[model samples]
Target: MSAIITVENVGKKYRLRHQKTETYATLRDTIVRGAKNVFSFNKVDKPTVEEFWALKNVNFEINQGDRIGIIGRNGAGKSTLLKILSRVVHPTEGRITMEGKIASLLEVGTGFHPELSGRENIYLNGVILGMTRKEIQKKFDEIVAFSEIDKFLDTPVKRYSSGMFVRLAFSVAVHMEPDILIVDEVLAVGDAQFQKKSAAKMESISKDEGRTILFVSHNMPAMEKLCPTSIYLEHGTVKKIGKTEEIVNEYLIATNAQ
Candidate 1:
């Protein structure tokens, strides 16, 4: 398999937000403070901001037909790396090179239109995921059938049971047939059955269809079953990268120690 994605010296920075209590009741009071801050050296005249690097000097490459799992504790930059790969956020430094169409399910209902019916949202999501309207039309039935939302297709997604909404969202995302797929732990929605189905579909898409998949999940057993490779991140860095068994064991042991 050839290199489908390459990430070089990638880093992400985020400003620490300090929410100041508002003392003014109206715009005039705020304006007065702003004017005073322009020439004043007093500490109260200016607000201070702090910044931190989320990901630093991160680098990796993924080949075609690879199913890699991203495993880490919370705030470990797993999602941050996925966001960069999905183009949801740009790195503060370095770059990413992508060779094929990429579709990401970073969250459930990410591209869904709440007011629209499930049916309408399907087409909308498909188009947003880079499919043409005609392409969506061609896969319309398959999408609905796979989602099992045929009966409630025309009902607004806002009215859907959480499971129905997740089904519709996951179905639309995975059906895009992109050469590269990035999935976060969005299968937490719906029931156990839906999670199983989604995992199966992802497995077939990556393992059988020769696509590259980057998966993030806390379910170690599921990761073992579905993914062949694992990348363990700790403190915003790749701690270990190798066969799923060894990497997952490292993740579990480290997390338990913590």
Candidate 2:
């Protein structure tokens, strides 16, 4: 099988405002901004910006039927790289070639309308993740069953507890069945039982269904259980790329250096 995803010399840069205070100068700033928008919306230029590279010269290939873990410390660009691949943010340089439907769970409860009922939001999230109405309908019952929120399905997500919201959102994401699934550290929420079930679901998606999964998580035991190969990132660069054991061991060594 050909590579399902190829990332070649990819780089992402973010221009950071030197002073974040200027972005939200004061409560009056919003009124001024609103008035400016009512007019021609002329750009007000005052804040200085510094370019920061979030991902640099990052090249990797993801074959079909692979579950790849992305492990890195905080501020190491793991989240930024996932956002780039998910199209939430565009990369500043290089090229990425993907040959399948892609769904990204960058964060739990993403792309949801808070005012929508859980059932309605499920359909909406499924559609946004590239599922057809027919497919979503087919999996509707299963999604609800897995989420364990049948009773609250009719309630607006804004009224649901945070835990309930995450459960429903996670269920929708898993049921969409995209060929390439990208997840970013969303296993932190939910009860322990749901977390275990979600892990099993992800493992099945990779091992049984032969999907390509790029998982970013700080949970070492869960990462070890799900990913046999991984990429370790450090300071916006690829620190190591190999077996999960190898990369994780290297990460341990590097962390101990502190």
Q: Could you report the Cα RMSD, in angstroms, for every candidate shown?
A: 2.8, 5.0
**What's the residue-level lDDT of 78 in candidate 1?**
95
Error of 1 at 201 (Å): 0.7
Local distance difference test values of all predictions, in order: 0.85, 0.89
lDDT, model 2: 0.89
User: TM-score for each prediction?
Assistant: 0.90, 0.87
TM-score of 1: 0.90
Tens digits of lDDT, candidate 2, 18-91: 75465546878767756666775565634567899989999999899999999999999999999889988999
Clashes of each: 0, 0
Question: Which residues of candidate 2, in runs, are more than 4 Å off?
Answer: 19-21, 24-48
Model 1: per-residue lDDT, tens digit, 1-258?
668999899999987645473643368756766888776778364545578888888888889999999988999999999999999898999988999788888887667988999888988888877888987888888889889989998899899988888888888888888899999998666788988898888999987899999999988999998888888887788777899998888877877887
Clashing pairs in 1: none
Candidate 2, TM-score vs. the true structure? 0.87
